[model samples]
Target: MTAKRIENGLMGLAAFLLLALMAVTGIDVIGRYLFNAPLSGAFELTELLLGALVFVALPLVSRAGAHVEVDLLVSVVPRAVSRVMGRMAAIVSAVVLAFFAWRLAVLGITQVTDGARSVSMGVPLAPFAFLGALTCLVAALFGLMREMRP
Candidate 1:
């Protein structure tokens, strides 16, 4: 599939996760305050969902060049120099993100082997960790693509 299509899919998934997180939090709040009872796993679920949402959104955000940047020097620099600086920044970002992805993958594997789970809910954390790693890899690839563009 094309990079754009992949980004679109990722973005959609992120959006869905965001909405789910909102609904889950809202329900938990109402249940706790109004009914004096809360969902058992709501906090753990929200934490996992938030992580997934951010990671899944990264690729699309990078692809769309929507990442926050301080452009104060861009106006003073020559156009060509500005472009080169932007590409260099992208390359650096890609390398950093790739490193993070690798670390996250390793951590995920370790967590799985150690049978790590959420404190309250006992939900498996390895899968979400691995998913975060995958999304980071995708985001790094997209950043590389952006840096390589003519």
Candidate 2:
């Protein structure tokens, strides 16, 4: 399958997770205020879902060239110079993201070895960490693709 398709799938998952998070939070808030009882582990689940949403969407956003940027230099620079600078920026972004992914992989392994879990729900964290690392790596690849593009 193509990278664009994979990125789109990840973006869809992120969107679904975000909607789920909203629902969970709404239920928790309403239940707590109106019913005197809140959903168990709602906060922990929200935290995990938020992380998943960001990481999963990263690659799609990178691929679409939708990331926030300061384009002040682009307005003043010649077209060729601007294009060169943009490519350079993409390369730098890819390198930074790759390093971040590496660190996340190390952290995930450590979490697994240490038996880390969410405090409220005891949800295993290593899986999510590893997922984040994978997404970050994908995002880095997308950045490199953008850099290589004409």
Candidate 3:
């Protein structure tokens, strides 16, 4: 319900996804080398999990303003100017991320209409696409929240 609670939930989800990715990769490697049989659709699973993990963690990073930045120009600017620059940067980031979310949602709808599936596993692609869109939208909101702070 609360922002911290939501952030914690996202962190837990990201951690779980990361662990699942590691387990999947390890099992796939062991199966391939020792048993002479790789896990079916391991690559697709990894790709999806990695993508999910990145997006899942994005909102937290945005909320914390923890994104990597080169502040060389900010150091040279007046405090007022630097503050304005930071706000402008946040606005730009939010806009770009929102655009991505919209585009991804559109792509997800298209995939659904086309009955798209993964190459090997035949896994439906629309859900993951929609998940990506949702996370990007949340990240964009967090970016705006960062701009609002102080």
Candidate 4:
């Protein structure tokens, strides 16, 4: 899919996940206080939702060009130099972020293989890891492309 479409989809998914988190959390709290029992997997669900928030936000932030950048130096630099500097920054960012993606993937796979799961919820943690790693990889690719821009 195109970057724009991917970004839009991610943003929408993030919003939906956040909304779901809030609703679930509220229900869980009410159930605990009003009744005697809380949702069985509420905590685990929240943990997974936290990962979802970060994973989904990355691409949207990239597409919006909302990530922090120091434009002051670039503004004063010559146009050609500024362009080169921007590309260099982008390349560095992509490289570093790609490493993060690698790490997350490794961690996720290890957990999955080990059969790691949430204590209360019994949900496998692999999905969160895999989703987060995939999104980071996508963002790294986008950054690499941005860096390659003329």
Each model's TM-score, in the order given? 0.93, 0.94, 0.94, 0.86
- Which segments of model 3 are wrong by more than 4 Å? none
For candidate 1, lDDT tens digit of each residue in 51-100?
A: 88888988888887889989999999999999899889988898899898
Q: TM-score order of candidates, best first?
A: 3, 2, 1, 4
Residue range 1-150, candidate 4, lDDT tens digits: 887788778878998999989988999999999997898889888878987898878866765667987688876889989888878887787788788889989999999899998888788888788888888888877776766755
Between prediction 1 and prediction 3, the one with superior TM-score is 3
lDDT over C-alpha atoms for residue 78 of model 4: 97
**In candidate 3, how many Å is residue 62 off?**
0.9
**What is the alpha-carbon RMSD of candidate 2 to the true structure?**
1.2
Q: Residue by residue across 1-120, what tens digits does model 2's lDDT show?
A: 888688778977988998999999999999999999999999899999998988998998899889999999898999999989988998899889989899999999999999999998
User: What is the lDDT, from 0 to 100, of the residue 76 in candidate 4?
Assistant: 81
Q: What value of lDDT does candidate 2 attain over all alpha carbons?
A: 0.91
Model 3: weakest 10-residue lDDT segment is 141-150
**Candidate 3, 79: how far from true, in Å?**
1.4
